[model samples]
Target: MPKIALHNRDGSSNGTVDLDDAVFDVAVNVPAMHQVVTAQLAAARSGTSKTKSRGEVRGGGKKPWRQKGTGRARQGSIRSPQWSGGGIAHGPSGEQNHVKRVNKKLKRVALRSALSDRARSGDVRVVDDLVFEAPRTKDALAFLDALEIGSRRVLVVMAARDQVTGRSFRNLRRVHLLTVDQLNTYDVLVSDVVIFQRAALDHIGKGSRPDLGQRGRRPSAGTRSDDADLGQRGRRPSAGSRSDDADLVLTGREQE
Candidate 1:
């Protein structure tokens, strides 16, 4: 991979950095990336929605009238779902849970895939450096205008944080500033283009660790395995301590 030079406001070079092909070279697979991104977003939902069944609702304890001998239709409990102020037959309750699950590896891959897609699409705008004269939205708006990103959602990727830049873009609904460390699949996928600082590319790439191998089995230091020995084996205590104590006690008794 070629080293890309990053710059300052005056078009001065900040530094040149190289990007790994493995991280940024993968062909963009829209279908696979879309599936993975959708799954991740679905998993993040609270899913805590619930509908109240007839029995779950309050009231409707006593029958309204006798079951027979009435001119009107037979009457049951006043709280019946069919009656007003009665228990709801099937009303939405607040308890319904909408949370879904996505494999950890899948989540990581989706993010990397999105980044690769952005890079391939030529939608990545790399700035050598970022400058803000003051903490104003106008300064932020000017940068967006210069970058030709007006009226579109842009993901501004910075190496660390530029508080001035952050504050400047905070109020702009169309612009989102994400530190390289904070970039995620949803934001990357949602944006029309990704604008990143040149110096921030290394930081972004460093944070973009691919979730290699199978989706479910991500090996970590915390995981236990049959093939690995994690700690020292248990050992027996010294065996002669009790006998020595017994002898000392006997000797004391004899002396007394």
Candidate 2:
């Protein structure tokens, strides 16, 4: 287990917390991190860049000159690639797929590797909490200043429900706010320091793996076992009820 110094919102020391060895003390895999980070960056591309080919250009319907009997070399459409202001050749067609496929296990390994690297470099910090009465940019800055985190790129990981803290840090230029669920290899590798809320750290530690919490091991609201049972009951009457109804119907027929 790797232990990191814990701090209050005001930067006061508040004991320490043990980070999960699986997450923070594992062997760093550089190649896995590189592949994951590359894939992440590739996925962010819009891939919408496009260029018009000669055939698709507006003015290409008319040829520039006859194919022969001209002093100059024969010419085709004015929109040919050789002509100025003409359509581009072999250019992007707006259908590019820059996304690289990385397996879930590889992604997890990469994230853990990045985190372990950061932890070994002593760039990981834990804060007790980031409760904010209101969204205050000044308070956010003060928190960073108290931690002596200067102008470096700081990645703050917090619980998803902490909207107030997120709002406070959103305006900071170098401070990136991400929920625990959004933590990934690229963000972790690009950051100079990682600040984890105590709650977020505990949540990560409770999981067996980096992304285990998101794997839907337990059913969520509206999808519980009880709900499924209720759905089954609503769809079909019980055997006892059917037998009782049949007996009642037979007795009614006998009386009739």
* Candidate 1 Cα deviation (angstroms), residue 31: 5.2
Query: Whose lDDT is greatest here?
Result: 2
- Residue-level lDDT tens digits of model 2 in 1-256: 6778999988999998888776787788899878867766666566789999888888767877888788889887789999988989999999998877776666667677888899999999999987788889899899999999989888887654456676677667577665565566666777799998887787676651233222111211122122210111111111111111111111111221
- Each prediction's TM-score versus the true structure: 0.63, 0.77
Residue-level error in angstroms, candidate 2, position 100? 1.6
Tell how far residue 1 is off in model 1, in angstroms.
4.1
Deviation in angstroms for 96 in model 2?
2.6
Cα lDDT for residue 79, candidate 1: 66
Collision count for each candidate, in order: 13, 0
Q: Give the alpha carbon lDDT tens digit for every residue of 141-218 in model 1.
A: 777776666697777766555566666766776665654544556567778888777756654445432221211211
